[model samples]
Target: MTSDKSFFDFISNGLPGPELRKDADNAILPARKLAFSRFRALGLPSVKTEEWRYTNIQRFLKDSFSLAQEEGTISAEQLKLTDIPQLDSYTAVLVNGRLQPALSKLPAEGKVTISKLSDAANNTQLQLWFDKHPHLQQQPFAALNAALFADGLFIEAGVNASLDKPLHIIHIYTTTGNAFIQPRHLMVLHKSATLEIIESSVGLNETAIAFVNSVTEIVLEENAELWHYNLQISEKNSRHIYHTSTVQKADSRYHHFNFTLPSAELTRNNLSVALTGSNTETNLHGLYLATDQQHVDNHTFVDHLVPNCNSNELYKGVLLDNSNGVFTGKIHVHQDAQKTNAFQQNNNLLMSEKASINSQPQLEIYADDVKCSHGFTVGRFSEESLFYLRSRGIGEEAAKTLLVNAFAFDITDQVHIPALQDFLSEKIRKYVSGAINN
Candidate 1:
């Protein structure tokens, strides 16, 4: 580990000589070089940066960290702790960004292909669409991951293919020392194909800090549909930055659900979708629960490039103790995007006097006939509602839990998976009840 070193300097100077060019594949070297150059030019964001004004990321990077990919193992007992109660699906288990084939039960290889990104370097789709999304061009962290990511998953669904069961991906982070990990992935759905994917994580670092920077790029062809869910509930010693970029074609439907819960010290999510064809439907929903001194930030963008597209976005937050939260949602309609309908809303609840939130919702429209609107709201728990629940014989803790659940109902109700919905509800109740008791 490099002691008292900045993250930028550590990446630029401290890494081993061969670390930068470890991927010797001639076909990918050009892309890697371009991404490395971009990262150098953009550098790291500071407090003065417009997009990162609310979160001071430099504070988290001040500690010592190792660039080397550490080797760690997980037992069956430890792996079971990260499982959802009633999820009956094929599983893919990754530890420190490396896939464990023995621990995973991947889907059959008829029309669906799931393998390691490193092994897919010679694949045609991997060569054509990897790291080519427009939304990832300007993100520094995304560029960094593209240049030096260790290993990740690659999934491709054939045309008109459909999965009978959902796919659950469990990410377990265990490290012997302070480390920085980067995982890069790409998923492509062919025309008229459909799939559902759920991602969750767990951290098992007793005394060391583990920071993860991950990027996942998705592509949906004409008439395709995707149901994507991301659940973040790592330990207190973990920090994360995630970027999910999706491109939608004509008549495609995309539904995304994000739930960020307790214990992680810092979490930042950047989600973006670009509509490239007409008559596409996009839905984005998010719910975040932050306690203690934790910090969570969500930034999203929807680009309407073609006509007859509809997009809707809603994100809610519950902040307790001295936690902080930030939300920024943007919608852009191009001149050719006639008949576009876009709506965005962000709402937050501050349970403690010291808890705070910063929200910004924006819309930019160039088409005169389009319908676009955005809104933001921040408030406390309604005293009247609490009193009514209390008067019905419910104790204070139970009343508060019920109120929080009711507040989160809008986002959770949109989940198509009944088991996942039940798991999220139980998690919310347990966290709220424990916080109130403390």
Candidate 2:
């Protein structure tokens, strides 16, 4: 059998030509070539890599997978078979990493601007926006994504505009069980603009095997407010590597809500947020559940570049069976960040003897007047709490469910959106019940 290294070889040797960039209007090819070179110079992470010590990603890699080189035909039937239940939000659909414009219903033209990457690439303003963001060459997966992404959603809200409903982005993969794809999304909110974004997925089973490298870039101008939520749930044989890079300006607010549920064979998420302006507030809350042999990892870094930027993070996870999970978070307070306030904590629950977690939370403070603290905990449910539930006539599974639900609430309840919160609650309950039943 071919080894995991073959996957890298396949991607590096298969870079496409200008036809792939025909609609991109030559705006992305240069970036794509640079990223491909970066990937070749610095290969995939190994066990020796400090950031990847906990997860053995090579075991999940394979050379048999094909790249989704062209748009896959999506039937009307496939459009209706979405994993996420319908919600009161604007919808944008992508099939096999290609935008399905006919199936997508965007907001009115003047209120906001939402278009496919190919169409948006022709806009001079969008090109300038891309030129101003941070470099993706530092992260191998991100570089690979940039090299391969053909199309994605580009959303920009005008200054002082407030979206009445959230924007829902649904990504569906279905070329072949053994094909890989990279999806990219870009969002920019002008000054005083407000919006909510929800990302969800679909179309996979245990027999499925695929690789997904995706990235989302965001920019928030002065006084803008953004609420982002991600629901990542995939099949047992699927591997997902996703990244989010965001920049916040002065007086802006950014809130993140994340839920990672069962059955993905491998999952890694990288989140980096830069507080470029003072008086910015950022909050991150997440819940992850892993069972069987699923492996999940979340790494977050917040850079406090200016004074008076406040950032807080709380992540909780439940691991059952032989599943493994990892959490590593860091908050940086620069010399000029005199009034920075940063706090980070990761709490995990191990439900089986073989279940394990590797958690590390770090704080780097250079300013004297900053308040920064970080910590982690890995433990089982409290015996007394479980006993009390059982004493109240609950069965073993029921008691465990009650306790797990309460533990997850510590992070889930912090989501202010009522409908989204309710949906997440039901999803978590179903995942917990499935784990106990298995």
Candidate 3:
């Protein structure tokens, strides 16, 4: 094993040189520099790192990926929003980490406020929020994002506001060769607010392997209700890594649904929910489909820090061909968290002998009075069901595809938006068709 010094030398001198900020550095630059120094001290996460054991970052380090330069160009019509569902509602478009105002369309009601992160100097409230959330400095990728991120979006819902239309944020990556893009977003829902948000990631160009490291933070105040949906559909040569954190207040309800389908290399997702007030509720659902030589990993943590909090999580995956999948979930009931109810479950379907899956569900209950349970299941398709489908004159391939789709329905059905549901269903069908043809 190489020493920490060796890793530092590798990143600072080896491969492509570290990118320097040429434009005017923001007020956060000094703090971000300190964060970079911290990242240097920590180095890349290896198998020795418990949180990164299943997903490796060594290969990513060796690759010559640099912060994207503002040289690429994309058109509004070329963004391919036509295929996306629920796009007629309020929408924001970002290409290669830069917000495209000309391509974006806002709702007519004007109840919501949207602006670029680069222009946040005038927003004192957002500035205060950033000051309070210095935890972003501890994250290596997030630190890098802070230092290099060019543009992002900030969304706020007024108190007692209810948005009839969902807000969709689209990030499109169209780099030619190997490139890296980091997009940051912060969302705030005030007291008694109700909002729906949809986030989608897409990549074009097959020759270059793109890396998208994104972070999003959501804050829900008292009695706020939020429904969030995330859809990731990158081409065969793209890698995606995401970190999403949520903070909920008293009587708040937050629900999240994530769908990951069709990526070429590796993808990792870290989702954390913190219940900071009493009577908070949270629900999480995820579906991942991997085929060929792809790899998908999900890590989730739920912290019940207050009394009378509730949380439930379900994650399912379908692994076919030589693909690999992993799920690790932990629910922590703090000492002060009395009357907490938490449940977690992970299920996987292996379609080929070479396919692999790893599942770990854990619960740490410091409060004896809390109710928490976790379970996992891993298996292949049911032979009895296959036989029944065959007896009904359905072709073997078609029957298998149908069963795979049915297995995915549990998570896909959770998407309440009609357009999004249709879009996701179509993508799943395409993946199933490809798996059958293979």
Estimate every model's Cα lDDT from 0 to 1: 0.89, 0.79, 0.77
Q: Relative to the unseen true structure, what is the C-alpha lDDT of residue 407 in candidate 1, on a scale of 0 to 100? A: 92
Candidate 2 lDDT, tens digit per residue, 241-319? 8888889999999998778887677888888898999999999987889998889999888999999998999999999
Give a tens-digit lDDT track for model 3, residues 1-438. 145566555334322223543223445555555656777755667877877777776665456665544446676566764357444567778877667778888665465777776676446555555423434444566655554455567778888987778878877887877777767777788898999988888777568777777777788899999999888887887888887878899999999988888865778887888899899889999999999988898988898989999999999999988998989898989899999999998999998999999888878899989888888999899999999999999888778877887888888777888888778777877887788797
Best by lDDT: 1
Q: By TM-score, is 2 or 3 better?
A: 2
Cα miss at 206, model 3 (Å)? 1.6
- For candidate 1, lDDT tens digit of each residue in 371-432? 88888888899999999989999999899999999999999999999999999999999889
**Candidate order by decreasing TM-score:** 1, 2, 3
Task: Show the colliding residue pairs in model 2.
Answer: none
The stretch of ten residues in a row with the least summed lDDT in candidate 1 is 14-23
lDDT of 2 at 370: 86
In order of appearance, the predictions have TM-scores of: 0.96, 0.93, 0.91
Clashing pairs in 1: none
User: How large an RMSD does model 3 have?
Assistant: 3.1
Deviation in Å, model 2, residue 322 alpha carbon: 0.8
